[model samples]
Target: MRRTARRAGKALGAGAAAALLALATPAGTAQAADGVLSIDGTEHEDPSGCFPLGDFAPPKIANLTDGTAWIWSGPSCDGQVTQQIDPGTSAIGRGRSLYIE
Candidate 1:
């Protein structure tokens, strides 16, 4: 009975430690995209958050990531949404910025 109790306690402790480790580690959910976002001919891998074009509005934009994003007519992801680019797709427009989710 004592040995069984000790084994159970050890198993419980291990489980607790594993849980703690899992909590401490960063989750993959924080990543916005899992693939690439091509702007013009340039490629951005594992893109997340807002991407400002900054003076250059490319005519061709591609979203090869596993996520969707919006092409904005202005910078900072605030303003008119020119287009919504989905995964494995592309758009032909003059966009000043891009926002991903």
Candidate 2:
């Protein structure tokens, strides 16, 4: 019984250490949310890219580029296009697709 208790204690200690490490590190592998689109809770570093809206159901958050960006209401850069997304301008609505050049 004593040996079993000692093993359980060591396991608990290791688990606590791992939990602390995870909390200290960043959550995702994306760049900072400064100048990129945060699609489906993931930030894309590049200013230009095609992200399928279908991949992120109920698309939540997004961040505009430094210069300018265009947002589309449909996937594949289709549908209504909202122009002039300036710096520090966060895309409030859930755009079906985002195109920045």
Candidate 3:
């Protein structure tokens, strides 16, 4: 019984660590800023042209099975931006404009 309890505790700890890592890691759609734009004191790269006022960082991006990804700005923010990129594309270069709506 003691061994079983230990195993369960270890499993729970592992699961929590995995969840924390997932939250800390940025998604594929999140492009790291190249010190170009600054918004709300956070350096962000806005690929979508919608939020032109300043730089904005998306909380997370959802990967769809149809080769498209959905970028979520925030938990309460209703607006979402979708980006279409080539399958081989990985990173966005500096001075490049991302589509925003």
Model 1, span 1-101: residue lDDT tens: 99999999999999999999999997766666988888777888898888877675465878889999888888888889988888999887567888886
lDDT of 2 by residue, 1-101 (tens): 99999999999999999999989998766333246666567877755655565634546545555645566778888888854356666544456676665
Residue lDDT tens for model 3, 1-101: 99999999999999999999999987766443222232233343423332332234432222112232223333322245333433223332121123322
Off by over 4 Å in 1: 1-29, 54-57
Alpha-carbon TM-score of each model against the true structure:
0.62, 0.47, 0.29
For candidate 1, give the lDDT of residue 22.
94
Higher-ranked by TM-score: 2 or 3: 2
* lDDT rank order: 1, 2, 3
The better candidate by lDDT, 1 or 3, is 1
lDDT on C-alpha atoms for all candidate structures: 0.83, 0.65, 0.38
Determine the C-alpha RMSD for candidate 3 after optimal superposition of all C-alphas. 12.2
